[model samples]
Target chain A: MDKKKINCLSSAISIHNLSKTYASGFVALNNIDLEIYHGEIFALLGPNGAGKTTLINIICGIVTPSEGTIMVDGHNTLTAFRAARSRIGLVPQELSTAAFESVLNTVNFSRGLFGKASNPTYIEKILRELSLWDKRHEKIVALSGGMKRRLLIAKALSHEPQILFLDEPSAGVDVKLRRDMWLMVRRLRENGVTIILTTHYIEEAEEMADRIGIINNGEIIMVENKAILMNKLGKKQLALTLQNPLSTLPSELEKFNLSFSDGGKVLIYTYDAQQEQTGIPELLQQLGEHGIDFKDLNTSESSLEDIFVSLVKEK
Target chain B: MNFYAIRAIYIFEMSRTWRTLMQSIASPILSTSLYFVVFGAAIGSRMGEIDGISYGAFIIPGLIMLSLLSESISNAAFGIYFPKFSGTLYEVLSAPISSLEIVMGYVGAAASKSIILGLLILMTAQLFVDYEIMHPLWMITFLILTSITFSLFGFIIGLWADDFQKLQIIPLMVVMPLTFLGGAFYSIDMLPEPWQTLTLFNPVVYLISGFRWSFYGIADVNVAISLGMIFGFMLLCLATIQWIFKTGYRLKT
Candidate 1:
């Protein structure tokens, strides 16, 4: 199965020069180019009204593109939409569902809607995986909000799509359910499904994403491996407590313009963690030469959330 | 072709009708029965015969058309409209099925329901007034054609409507009035002067006349003209649907 997927495709999804402009002249998405690989969990991070939903909608064929084209597994989303859409599934952000429909029937409806034949055994498998089998006979309106979110996942996976787009899957969900969703996502990746999700929860991406992409103001600012992003952009801070208070930094450290707090009783230095020369050694040597002594020294590294905040702030 | 997808939608919609049995089948049948009791049994008796057929029997086809048009429109309209109202339309729009298949599934189901309701009314009318079918096959044909035509129109109303009030505007304000004035209770011959000639302008007149001709072999308009008018209205509806899909008017952003 893995060999067949790569026989003719370079990437699972490829977007080129994509843009969407509403009739009201609102540019929902700018010229965007991106490539998503197979068997990888990619998380898209963005703030409110940042075009995350619009981008996901366009790729899923729910919204038409004003200009440019999208191909899903080498199939153009428009020209060969049947071939393209059959291999993809989308779990929308809204909790809008058939309030009167049974959970089992609605899931079956989605599978048939994607042109797949009936497979009760397979449907039962997904239902059990989402922990919805017990509530399968209940109407969707009877389930709790968390269960409805899980039902959306069951519907998306009903047809066994190769690529899944979950738009804010964890929104309004409890911690236990979020963890369960993350575990399910990882399991899907292991089975060779390419997953793309947009989330405001930095921890979700930090824990689940193999790669991360940050989008802001309708444009993608950066896309990098999760580990590489954290390391490259992660800033480390060194805090030193002085043995005696000083009026200010010595003349030799004036060029660095180091930050001092607590009435000059403490000194702080920040530098890139990944760089070979973080300037920490140079600063300490200069401090020793200047006779600036500290009784205590501690270092702190920034988390993924800090990096995300700084990146969005920069743009 | 996505026949499997089409079947799924068709079955889903049909099940909605089954779930709301009182509204879908019983309400229309009960109301049509009321018309038979008042007009076909009471007023129709004193009204006496016209063109050799009893007044009660003459209005049977017209009464069936009245319910057929309204039921077809509302069934198709509400079936699609509820999904939009509840935000479930996204799933249908994003599905791999084509627009044509979507129409077939919805319109097909609505028309089937209307035809069944029409036949049920026809049988119920027999209890109030005795009637004969001069052309049984043509009677069934008119039932099928009128149901399909009005169902397509209803689908358009569903797509165009944004609210519940808008959904009812066409069926209540437009279709019901037209049917009432389309000679549903009396033949155009009873009207005075140019009014009889002017009645041709009402499109419903053709539908009711063609259907009456199928029942009693008597009609105000020629059978061919009535058939042509029905086909014309259906084509206009089909063209409008094609334009809607092409522009992605209400379905897409």
Candidate 2:
């Protein structure tokens, strides 16, 4: 391989025009195009039936695609599955570890499955990182739900994969454990591992993702840098508390697109977040000039969830 | 198909089978003992000689076949089906192990169990009757071939079955009926002409006849014909199992 090929191989994952239709005629993925960098945390957000798992399944070589192709670490996923899969780790949605096996053996066996020679230290590190080292000798059936979930992460990372796919890692986890998982994900990224995560938790994406992909109905609606996406699509809100309640908006204040709320004691205005100026001062001045008095003022910005819902709705 | 990968899967499966050692070893031994007590002692006393051989000795081959067929099917079926039932099949499917490796591991384990059970029953039958192996080499060959054939059949049953109930259908509905009707207890020649000719269509007859021929040097059907049927069934099973692996039947989707 040449230098360019080596560079491409180091970037972790890429997918182009991938599609899958089940035997039952459900189109699980439709023309997905994506590229994941070597060390960034990428978040995939979608509704219940949005094909997140199917897409992951295709890239991992679990589900054969009806058309198109995917490349993992520059190796074609279908033609060079072993090499491709060796570099990618998958944490499946289902909690399906062997109940009769101990935690340590389960994770170690996963490493051996990848054709890697045994490395006790590597296994220990993974178990310790996932906070499962102490329970390593215990049978899987004896573990709590939270511990089982953590063990899944340990198993996925057992082979020291360059990229890890987490499918709703925190779906049923308590808030504290969820935070711990996020921290572990960050540490993995710092070690030059790429992460692609799917979740219904918008806050998780907002807090962790460097890039966000919004999938709806088997299609990716948008993929953008998190900050830029927020700046471009996020809305800003301006609220003014009235010194006295009113029955309706002032006829002059209507020109500024201001609306009344809180029983007409507050005048609310929404505008683009990316604008050089929101024109909020002019609107407040107009409210004052129109004899609308305010006792206090507050401003807020739209959350990622708001942008997520609006983008999905737009699709 | 890598050697180490095959070894890993084989060893794992063997360990799993060994975990239920008591059931696999004891159940067949105990069942065969009942056959010896009820059929060989009580029934054979009145039945007299069969083809100049003691009635107790005549039933040995059939009893061994019964044990082989039952254990082979259960081992293979439970090996694959339970993994799927517990959702661990997904783990195996997702691993770097190829379909061939998975099949070989499971079928190999099942065949081993069948051979062990067959051998144990043969040894236990000796305690009841003074049976002799007419052709030791043929006996070993038939034992191995039947074990592999039946184990593969069990694998197909595992892949086709969707639930625990579906898994049981083959062992109970198909295997049991065929074994009983296939002349495990009596020679087909003893049946009325029509039933004798009709019994020819049952595949289990070929296996039992071939095994009995190895033991007594006498068979209802030509030994070559029995061997051909066994190999044919073995090939059919291999092809079906290979197809199952290639298409991801029941394992995927």
Candidate 3:
């Protein structure tokens, strides 16, 4: 293959113009176009019912798309389902395990399902990485919720898929499990496996993702590099507690996008973080010229959560 | 043809049977034995004979068919339904195996279990009465064919049904009644003209009659017709499953 062809094929997953309208006439996804580079952690951040699971399920081939096409490792997902699916692993959102089967056997069975030869050593390594090795002989029903979630991850990785999708992996878990999950995700990325996770947790995306995609109402609103998105959309707010309450803003302050609240006891100004200058000095000089004295002032930078809510609310 | 995937699913299903031995194996055996004690010994002694064969020997094949049909459907249905209910079916669906492999694994395991139970009932029936097998090869052929056909039927039911009640409704209300009225314990031949004609419409009658003929060399339907009916039913089940997989019926969307 040529270098360009190899680079295009190197994409772990590529989706184009994908849409799904369920049988009940509910459109779960609009036309979506995305490309996930190999060996990167991509987090799909969306609120509940934003078609996050629907999109993930389509990529994993669990759900069929009504239109468009998807490719995994350059193989068409629908036409070459087996080849495409062999490269992808999905840890579904729900917690489901064979209660009667032992952990070791379940993982082995999952590996065999992908037409992979038995590799006891690889299986052992996965179980150990997930800290499920000690409970290998125990039935899944006997494990706690955290352990069962970990087991789901183990099963997804059983076939050693190049691309792993963790759908809401930390939906309802303790702090310790969340920590362990991210740690394991990092370890996997170090080994060059592409990871795609869907989550409602903004902090998880901020902490783990190289790129973030925000979905809302069956449409992907934005996709950008985490650092770039933060720098571009991050907003800082400056709030001032006035010594004397004002009935209204002065005509001189009309040029500034300022707002008064708490019956004019406080004044607030918002500015973009990525601007060459915040214009804080100009704001203070204008405030002094207007004879608006403040008791105290504070500045705070908005987190990703704030940006996400405003983006969704804008739609 | 992913034999490894098929073997994995088959072994997983078979292991479930061993886990629920009392319910899957023991219960059916004990229930079939009770049928033998009540129908074969108690009723046969007073009923004289059916055709040229003694009443005790005559009901043996019918009784085995009764258990075989019900057990085959219930076993296959439950085997597939539990995975769907528990949400573990996604793992199998997302795997690299084809739909045909999945059906073969599930139906094959269910049919094997039913066949083993059917043969065990045959051995147990011998303790109650001496039954002659006029064509042993035919008997074996019918046993396997009936187990597989009914197992496939059960697999379809498992996919179509959305709840536990739907699962039980067909086998309990429909299958058991048909088995009883299909000449399991008595020949349809003895019934009056209208009743006999009505009984022939019941598909289970063909199965029981064919199996009984294998034992006593007598039949209510021709042996060739019986075999044809079974193959026809098997083909129907296969077609339905193929459509289900292709359309992504309940499993995909």
Best of the candidates, DockQ: 1
lDDT of 3 at A196: 95
For each candidate, what's the DockQ?
0.81, 0.54, 0.81
lDDT of 3 by residue, A12-96 (tens): 8889999999999999999999988888888999889999999998888789999999999899999998999999889999998
The estimated TM-scores of all candidates read: 0.95, 0.93, 0.95
Candidate 1 wrong stretches, greater than 4 Å? A1-9, A241-257, A260-267, A285-297
Return whichever of 1 and 2 wins on TM-score: 1
Higher lDDT: candidate 1 or 2? 1
Candidate 2 residues A140-240, lDDT tens each? 99999899999989988988898899999997899999999999999998888899999999999999998889999999999888888888898988888
lDDT of 2 by residue, B1-253 (tens): 4445556566666776676778888888989989987889888889978889888888889888888988898889888888888876665666677777777778887898788788888888888778899999999899999998988999899888888898888888888899989988888889998898999999999989999999999898999999999999999998998899788787776
- For candidate 2, the per-residue lDDT at A176 reads 98
Clashing residue pairs found in predicted model 2: none
Quote model 2's TM-score.
0.93
Those runs of model 2 whose alpha carbons end farther than 4 Å from true positions after fitting are A1-11
Instruction: Give residue A153's lDDT in candidate 3 (0 to 100).
Output: 97
Write down the TM-score for model 3: 0.95
